[model samples]
Target: MSLRRILKSWVERYFSDEEALILLLVLIAGFAAVIWFGRMLAPFFTALVIAFLLQGVVSALTRRGIPHLLSVIVVFLGFVGVLLALAFILLPLIWDQLIGLVQETPRMFASGQNWLDELQSRYPNLITPDQMQNWIGVASREISQLGQRALTLSLASLGNLLSLIIYLVLVPILVFFMLKDREALVGFTLSLLPQKRALMARIWREMDDQIANYIRGKFIEIIIVGTVSFITFSFFKLPYTALLAVLVGFSVLVPYIGAAVVTLPVAAVAGFQFGLSESFVYVLVAYGVIQALDGNVLAPVLFSETNNIHPVSVIVAVLFFGGIWGFWGVFFAIPLATLLKALVHAWPRGMKGRDERHHALASEESMEESL
Candidate 1:
């Protein structure tokens, strides 16, 4: 076939289906809105997510014979109660732990420097003075950068306080109405959609189930891991148990890397405190068990269906989305990746089998090779 014929074939394969065109247009429009006006619509988007998460609870209660409006009120109150507890109970509890860690920082730095000096003294050939100096310089610069960022955020907080207040005020109101008027809202949205939304509905169903499981499973995982870690560390009389537990909890946000990074501090604290004794071994073993169980057992149970995306794909998605949207992007990277995969799998292709398309391309390649 000529080049023009190949181009026509490709266009027909991609764009001949009406449903595919509509889906493509909708995806483009949605992405455009988020990319162009993300900051402006962030609060509304945030409200939508919270309401979507809480919908499960409202639905569960409704199924148990409770009225929809009553369920909404009950769930909303529970949500507010969580916020209050975080503000009042959780903050004060962690504040003391933070202060203790801050106070120990200088001591830890001095000890680290002394240790480096000792290493240089003992292994002059392996660890030269110049190498040690360079390492220390790098460490110092990194610490300075971290401190500068914190200071910048502190200054930014004051200017952003009104925005924060607006979010707090507006999000809850939006969430409430969203939950209370859920049916009407959904009806309105569906009415706006195209009459033939079979493809859209299918995508919605798949996304709904997976996203719900992923989000809820994550929330539960964090709580369970954190609570277990806190109890285990406390039982072992580890210093800074609260702070370490919090780190371990949030570490689940990043699958493999977070746990590994956190293990350094835990082992360091244990080694400094216990000096390679039985208790130190015990703590590490316990931590290892928790991680093993989470990876092998808890995660599998929580997410019954495999996402079928590779770890490399996951990491790339995280990097790509996180670069665009920052923290929230990182958090939702897996779901977004899964959504992309679903879209690719479901995209119309002029009724051609994917394998057939691949075979045709391979045949062309073989013909070119022979020629």
Candidate 2:
């Protein structure tokens, strides 16, 4: 048969409904497998993300005429220094509070039991004192068991400290190499594609730009939120202010739920120490003001065009990933979602179709300036 006839027959066969269904099923199965594997490798993935973020810093340093090796060392040392400073400033306070809380656990349980007993005596229709005592006993036992398990894990993992050391040592090294060789990697990958598809390199570069901008903007936002939270909590004379502020900062890394989760614990402690009404109002107002500032001022100034995710999408991604993969999932949901959005935006459009529909507004600006 002629080449045109053969080509027509091949297209007809391959683009049939049955072929399309099979392709769809295969794609779905492949995606499921990838997700399962990713879940299993979550920790390494987390480390890689950390490295990816730091790679930009390393690149900047190199661009400033710093040697790659020295830049990596400086970045790693800076990270360690920050961690040490936080530990020195915050750990002692947290240790004292933790010790006090541990010592007071029995007292808290007794107080709870006493309250239950008084309620039983007043009503005589609620749970009997004996039942309340049994419930307390069960709860106390569970708490004791959980504490023992946690202690055991901590102790047993001391020998495994070397693994963590290795990871810490390797990440900066990997990041330095990645930053130094990024262009080469891109060129090598693109070389494998046909000339017709070589323009994908530009698309990939745009995607990388989006990811880098979002990550850098996010870090700045977290720092701003943390600083604001620390100042607010300190002014209010809240308990565990340092720890709570750190929690708030980390929560800001996640979207939507971060502020709420950070505030809840701080509010609970405040309520217990002060009074319910005062603590509730204080935390509610403090977080509200901070959030308002973040939304109106800080975000617009720093992350103006970086992350354009809808609030609904943020909530859904957090819930879905958090459910499947726990804390890391929640922590990474927004960045990962942002990366996916970038990829979708970068995907090649049909030759005769509308091509700008999926692109971010920032990319349009870049295009306009280039033109």
Candidate 3:
């Protein structure tokens, strides 16, 4: 047979249905293995996230005429110093409030029962006090069990604390090397690709820009949310304002629904502490205002370009990852979504051919322009 006929026959043989099915299974298994491995390497994943976030700061310092080593040192020292200061300032307050809350748990339970009694008195058709008490008892038992489990987990990792310290020590060292050699790393990676595909270097740079913008925007948003929450809590004369505000603020890092998770518990406690009506209204209004500001003003201004994800995609990713990986999944949902979007845009259009590829490239270029 001629060479052309032999080439055509080889292609046809390789593209057979059985081969395709085998390939599909292989791909699926490979993907599953990757996910499992990623889960197993969770601590390294966390460290990588921390490094990615601090990269921009270190780069900025380096660009401003600081030596790379000194820049890394400065960034690391500043970070640790800030954390230490915050610990000194905030931990005592939080510790005291937590201790007080533990001591007052019985009183809080009584207050809850009183509130239930008031509700029953106002609406005689409601459930009986005995039923309510039973429900509360069940809830209390569950909460106590959860608390015990949490304490066990915390104490169980006492030996791992040394490893955590080593990780903390090594992170800045890794960051320093990464920041110093980032350009070289990029050049090396690009060199591995064929010359015809060098244009992809630009695409990678763009993706990096997108990720950096997102990280910086998120930092700003967290600060804004925390400050606003603290101010609002102080305005309402709420108990444990510092602790609650800090919780709410830090929870903002998780994207979409996390702020509410933090707020709801604080509000519930506030309701039990103050009158139900007063605390309910205060927390409701405060959180509502903060969310509105976040959605309308702060988000639009800072995250307008960074969050190119659709609401449906966000919800799907959150649910899928949350189910698979729990808290870490939820924390990483947005960044993961962003990375997925980048990959989708970068993927080759095979079935649709060059026209579709061109169109996709054009659309991506337009999106970059808009950004």
- Candidate that scores best on lDDT: 1
lDDT of 3 by residue, 10-69 (tens): 555443333233434644774587478865665556656666777889989889998988
On TM-score, who's better, 1 or 3?
1
Local accuracy by lDDT, each model: 0.84, 0.67, 0.70
Q: Sort all candidates by TM-score, best to worst.
A: 1, 3, 2
Candidate 2's C-alpha lDDT? 0.67
Number of the top TM-score candidate:
1
Clashing pairs in 1: none
Question: Each model's TM-score?
Answer: 0.86, 0.66, 0.75
lDDT over C-alpha atoms for residue 77 of model 3 = 74
Ordered from best to worst lDDT, the candidate numbers read 1, 3, 2
Better of 1 and 3 by lDDT: 1
Runs in model 2 with CA error above 4 Å? 1-47, 59-73, 83-163, 184-203, 277-280, 342-371
